[model samples]
Target: MINPVHLRTLVEVVRLGSFAAAATRLGYTASAVSQQMSALERDTGVALFQRSARSVLPTEAAVVMTRHAAKVLTDIDTLMAAAARTHESTSQELRLGIFPSLATYVLPRILQNPAWRKLGIELRVSVAEPGQTIQGLRTGGELDVALVYQVGQSGLAWPHTVNRQWIGDDDFRVVLPAAWGIGPESKVAADHLSDMPWIMHHPGTSDATVIERLFASCNLHPRVVAYSDDFHASLEMAAAGLGAALVPELALLHRPPGVVVLDVPEIRLARNVFALLPKEQLTAQVQLFVELLADTLHKLGTTRRD
Candidate 1:
């Protein structure tokens, strides 16, 4: 069989019109070039060049093969280059595990990075609840990074093999139903909630920490009639007047018709969003994602409040 190298040599010899010139151009001995063309002829069962003492002429078939070989070599070079670039760009996959609370809101905005497409990043986002995310990261299941609300206490005190950064501060303020008559434009305070039933995040979750802080600040025991871990479920329950719960601004991206985000002062009930990544996850792509996520959260903190 004719090697691509040998075929390339045949094409060059045909183009330059001499074995010596093709050899000079290709850094091969003249005799080597002649032997390659002979091998090419033998492989294809057709003589490719007519040899002379001074000039080598192409056989009738050699001219056709030479023309086509030029295009083939060009295509092969292009394919190899593109393949190399693809491999280089996608050398690593970014496995990101996001808390469910964030999967529906802030995470989408981070995906809109102008450079995401260019880098050929394969983003794998796991939308398990917070506990599962931490579990997966700890057990080395598959998370390269995670976005989780900072629980008041760390569960996996395993020296945190990952690097972490606080992304944003989400005020765990109250969410009141539209009919509360708090006025569409008014920011409700904790004191005004004296007559309102309290809606709090599910007991023992990150949001619960903020809720407990709010009650302690008011010096009143909360009448938390209902609680939910699912943000959407908690919001719906709140909309239906189950009770008023504190939800972050990102969760309220598109407000329902009868809801208001009540602002509270020095509300210690705030969840500090954090981006967690394994130390090995600090590749250029993962670093870019972490930066994108942090920037997105900061923007939401400033501009996304309802």
Candidate 2:
């Protein structure tokens, strides 16, 4: 029987045009690739390549073997891809991921559930900034599944390799400096902030863009006092007489003594959250938890999302 490893080395060496190049691509040393070619030739009882100082050229028999070897490699890749698809369609472990805020807020309800534990889910979760999450998916380093927050209608973009489920909606409200005496019972207009200093989200972030557009709609852009990624920092700043900030109502774990949340009059532009998976790795467990998560969010009236 022919050795597939030797055949693979042969194919790589020829396709890549040299042992050195193939070795680099395959993470083998140049000496190792050369030894593999010699061993393969000895096994076949034929010299497969002619070597000179500069390069290696295939022998006539090697030419024919390379052609057939290419087909073998192609078939192997096709078989592996199909096998992966089958596995994804049949898997049971529920590996998971969620954005940091949701990790702290809504995710606990699903993760800590007594009933879900009965499903025998092999639940794994990860928390990180959105940029890190996307990077992880690309490199196969971090998550096989992810729940993320995104702005407008686009949600998160995880390459064509990922499949997404739109899970929930996230909206922000205008916050007033503390001692403004606003409560959940209070209603304030966006126009009310037209004169107040706008404590915007950290610059170069989605929140900044949304906050800018909202204030522009009110025909104003006041001096932005501070920009920070942390909502608590923004809240503290606003409370300290810095400026008004836009804070997400659901994920605000703390309200410093001086800040008040006010409903923006007729305000509606918001981000939607998503559940994501590598298109190549959506195991059955991934599907169940995502569905359960959506259900839980819906039950909590976080269900207004499509």
Candidate 3:
């Protein structure tokens, strides 16, 4: 009998076209992933990949197996989900991992919705960053679903066994201290703020790297005055006239009195938010919960604009 675990790894290898890529997504070492592929070939008595010094090329057999493996995996997931639901109680408890911004701005509003009460889901919420929330969705981890965001090439990856759903995009805006005399209607260019002090994310963060590259592309090399990872804190600091900060629209919903948000044509970036759920854990209730999140996120954006 072929191991389902190996099949999952095989699917990843074929989809990503390299053992190393699959390794990163599945949280395995490249060597371990290679070994799993070897084991899978042995179980099936067929050559799965053509291995070269720099690359691993999937064989015809590998592609065929992957196609079949997808269906097999889906069936296995369905079986597991059905088995688990057989013993489920009236009010199902869902372990949800979410980032701070969404939890703060979107969650409370969703909870108040009458539709949420009808879902009969008791949410066990874990508020954390995307990295932590993703970890919680892995096998043997605590969360059944995680809400995460990816900014540019942030290198965020999840296991192939996890299903991903696109929620919405949170666009970043250039915010200046009201004291700086930059108002919402000011047509600003990147060079205009090049010499100004700026509040930024700490160096070495994925978002910071993307934002830095964006600023560099726009020829805006801001002098660093402060570093803040928290969007709310960044807003507060900007309002305090510390420096200009780039904040997402979601965070701007609760903007303080002294910060002016501008739509800088030069700085265009948005974090793509998604919900990750393990295949076997996906259920009607969970899908409904994700829908509620997407709806709330849309409403939040609309409310901010209005």
Top lDDT model:
3
lDDT of 2: 0.63
The model with the greater lDDT, 1 or 3, is: 3
Q: What lDDT score is found at residue 32 in candidate 1?
A: 55
- Provide the TM-score for each candidate, comma-separated: 0.65, 0.62, 0.70
State model 3's lDDT.
0.79
At residue 231, candidate 3 shows an lDDT of: 86
Predicted structure 1, TM vs. truth: 0.65
State each model's CA lDDT, in order.
Answer: 0.63, 0.63, 0.79
lDDT of 3 at 191: 86
- Model 1 weakest 10-residue run by lDDT: 55-64
Count of backbone clashes for each model? 2, 2, 0
- What are the root-mean-square deviations of the candidates from the true structure over C-alphas? 18.3, 17.9, 12.8
lDDT of 3 by residue, 205-257 (tens): 99999999999999999999999998899999999999999999989888999
Q: Write candidate 2's Cα lDDT for 1-306 as tens digits.
A: 233444566667888777777656654446556666776667656666656544343321222234434455566665445545554454455556667777776677776664345233566777887766777777754677777777663334677768878877667766777666667466666665567677766666765676667678776656766667787778888888788777775545556777766666656655577877887665333554665576566555543221
Off by over 4 Å in 2: 1-95, 153-156, 181-187, 302-306
Q: Quickly count the clashes in candidate 1.
A: 2
Candidate 1 vs 3: which has more TM-score: 3
